[model samples]
Target: MNRFALCYFLLCVSSAATAQDKEVQAIRTRYQETAKKVQLLEQDPQNAALYVHRISLNDKGTPWPAVGNYKKTIKFYFELGDEQVHTLVRIDITSESAAHQYATEYLFDAKGQLVFCYDRMPDGQSPENNIEVRYYFSGDKPIRRTEGKTISDKPSPEQQPQAKRLQSDAAELQSLFKAIDK
Candidate 1:
């Protein structure tokens, strides 16, 4: 309305764009440095699941580290509403931590565009502590937001992270899941 108000709005919009560009470039740089990761993305699709994760706390407002980012990956499988195959690949990140007491999950379409995002609770408070991401995309480009199903139960003791027991346990679980999913 007023000239001062309009100027303020424009500055805010410009600053936001700059911040987003920086974030994307930082991620791309990380990908470049890890050439092996890029190679895997080109080669083994399954193993490329490694890139499916990253860590980032939301600071879009307020100070840095006000939130906590637990896990992220560049590759994930999705089966929604009887889809024939995994419809979208994502670079997923979660911002949830004990200290901040906030959690957010985002799904970027394969082409690295935000398709849909679940901020805090999209529909309502989830029954569990974990956040669920549900989004749609056209090929690699994003289509729109979608309903998300979540795991209400807590992670099992075996699922808890352990320094030494992780590898063997993960391998064993992966085998079990393979058999069961089949």
Candidate 2:
């Protein structure tokens, strides 16, 4: 109520906002760096390690010719080092269908934490009908999210669950890749 008290409260609030803004900027920088690493590795395919897995949804044990059910394909990309350590950098999951087609890409940090995820689906035959969503994470938490052309500094309630699902999927895929590698 008093002038001094009001001024102090405003100053504290302003400081908090400034700190949050700085933190968000740092996260965005990290995201950009990670994205660059992925892009570079992807460009140089000869040096990158990639594993592809295909899933069939047919009731019978049939191959690709059987077209009634949906088919899913997953691609895992790893960064290879001289130390013989293969670090998983990206995972792409694509579902094939005549009517509905969607793809999700997940990117992991050096610590094997989910750092970013992108999901895209086409609403129609044209490129303009594409729906895209991107999520940027800090550790296991999503720090920012974007849908289409809109961006949000704070993750929505739905993003928490989606982040968890992506993390789980990444872990499972990593384990499968390790087993197959051995």
User: By TM-score, how accurate is candidate 1?
Assistant: 0.25
Clashing pairs in 1: 51-74, 52-73, 52-74, 52-75, 53-72, 53-73, 53-74, 54-72
State candidate 2's TM-score.
Answer: 0.66
Best by TM-score: 2
For this target, which candidate reaches the highest lDDT against the unseen true structure?
Answer: 2
Tell how far residue 159 is off in model 2, in angstroms.
Answer: 4.0
List the candidate 2 regions with Cα displacement exceeding 4 Å.
1-44, 47-69, 122-128
**Model 2 clashing-pair count:** 0
lDDT of 2 by residue, 109-180 (tens): 677777778888887776347788887776767767788879887777766787678678778977876776
Model 1, 1-182: lDDT tens per residue? 69999999999989976765565455444434444554675688566633332223344433436433433222233322244323233333334332333333333344434333333432334425433333332233322333345321223344333212323332343344334433
Model 1 C-alpha lDDT versus the unseen true structure: 0.39
